[model samples]
Target: MFTRFSPYWLWGLLSIFPIFWTYLVLASSNPSIVHILVHPSGEWAARLLIFTLMITPLSMFFKNSALVRWMRRNRRYFGVASFAYAAMHTVFYVADKGSLAQVLDELPRLYILTGWLAFAIFVPLAATSVDFAVRKMGRHWKALQRWVYVSAVLTLVHWASLNDWNSPLGAVVHFTPLVVLEGYRIRHHFAMRMKRTA
Candidate 1:
């Protein structure tokens, strides 16, 4: 019964995010909503991306089979949410600029280009997210999805370079959990390598 309803639970949880954030954006004042739309949308994407990355290491650490299963199952949902918010962020950017051409003109800027590159990586990852794609692509699908790590790095760069960390935005602080998790992963890799060498 739990298995049957887990997807429903996931859908409901996911639905809350879009509905709440969209409502906040819509209710916000006009001039402030410009920043409101872009920031919340982009930050949510980053947060979800980090959570997706954490599923593997976190599941490994906890040693809880049910937790592991849930994380693995919901990972794709988190990934899709990440991409959706990224799309919204891009839309907000273009909308704020008031013209597609105006936004295009800024593509040459380093920060803008970095964000674009991250979004580009998201496209294929989101496209091939289905189970059929997994079966069809087999080994290659995993390789393609590894690009997600590259996107994460690019996203961090874009956020850091574009926003102030010490300000109310707390941009850099938002990635704290991800940094800690990744640090744990790095240490574990070295520990394994040392054991192998011994």
Candidate 2:
């Protein structure tokens, strides 16, 4: 079944289509719908980041090395899409607020501050994503790339802390997969260390 199609591009396209579709649906709705669209679009980007992050862990745990190959090949696309949605989110927010002055007014607010930090964190990660940039940055590349994890956590924080922490539905829905993926990576890393010592 996997042989019939190109895994990376084909699957990635399938994964991302719903995001654009949702954006269109939201755009066609109420004038105040931009916030709704941006939030979920940003969430989808986080989810894709999880999907990209999960590929290696899944491949390792299941002993399917090809999955890692396919995922790594498309990892850049995931990062790129994450940036794209984030950009859309910023645009929506700016448009929704009407002007720079209005946006500046919201800047001191917690929701705006949290989201601003998350998007600010993503900008550099996206910029340094290419092969040439990575090679040039050397060890700094890995350090800078860890910003994705920060962005992911900040994304959830931005959403969860918006109204109240008691609203666990949104956090649970998004954070669960991230927790699982991180757990798997922890186990995989420990196992590798154990093997080296053995």
Candidate 3:
């Protein structure tokens, strides 16, 4: 059975795993599990971002955007998944501390405000991810989604704030790859534009 058709089962399974796992872990955890669960959410966000970034490079290498059709189809879903994690992380912070006002008051101290802001940006982007919203926003939808870039940066900041030593070496390691990926994307776009002009 495994030899018969691997592609259909493999990619399809991997793509949907995040969604299933998110809900599954959320439901299965005990009351003390809130912290552990939030960790997965942050990690999931990073994983989803990396997955989305991989799409273009994979398409380029394969010489076929069709290879990444499933990724394109589920980009919004992974994005929303990331937002779900971030939101849950926020909820944990608020709930554990007890009181929205206290959380808001201490927000600056924990630097959770950065995470809050990043999640806030994700809200509208996720809300308007559908075709109807794109049509309604006209050309503005793309610009609005550009907030993801800002959200990504803020996410790194939020992660950095959680560090005890402010070293954030791991965050730098995570972010540097994305910086390189974006650089490649920019260069690729420019080269394409130049080729078109030529």
Highest TM-score scorer: 1
Every model's TM-score: 0.84, 0.79, 0.74
**For residues 135-162, what per-residue lDDT tens digits would candidate 1 score against the true structure?**
9999999999999999998888788777
- After TM-score superposition, the amount by which residue 71's alpha carbon in candidate 3 deviates from its true location, in angstroms, is 1.2
**Where's the lowest-lDDT run of ten residues in candidate 3?**
1-10
Give me the candidate number with maximum lDDT: 1
Across residues 1-198, which tens digit of lDDT does each residue of candidate 2 receive?
Answer: 334446555647745655665557566757667656666666676676667666666676666666566566667877777777777768777876778999998888766788899899989998988899999999999998888888877777777776656675776687787688788789878999999999
Each candidate's lDDT (Cα)? 0.82, 0.74, 0.69
lDDT of 3 by residue, 96-133 (tens): 66677887787785447777787789889889988899
Error (Å) of candidate 3 at residue 117 is: 1.0
Candidate 1 residue 72 Cα shift, in angstroms, is: 1.7
Pairing residues by index, what is the TM-score of model 3? 0.74
Stretches off by above 4 angstroms in model 2 are 1-30, 191-198
User: Which residue pairs collide in model 1, if any?
Assistant: none
Given candidate 1, what's the lDDT at residue 145? 98
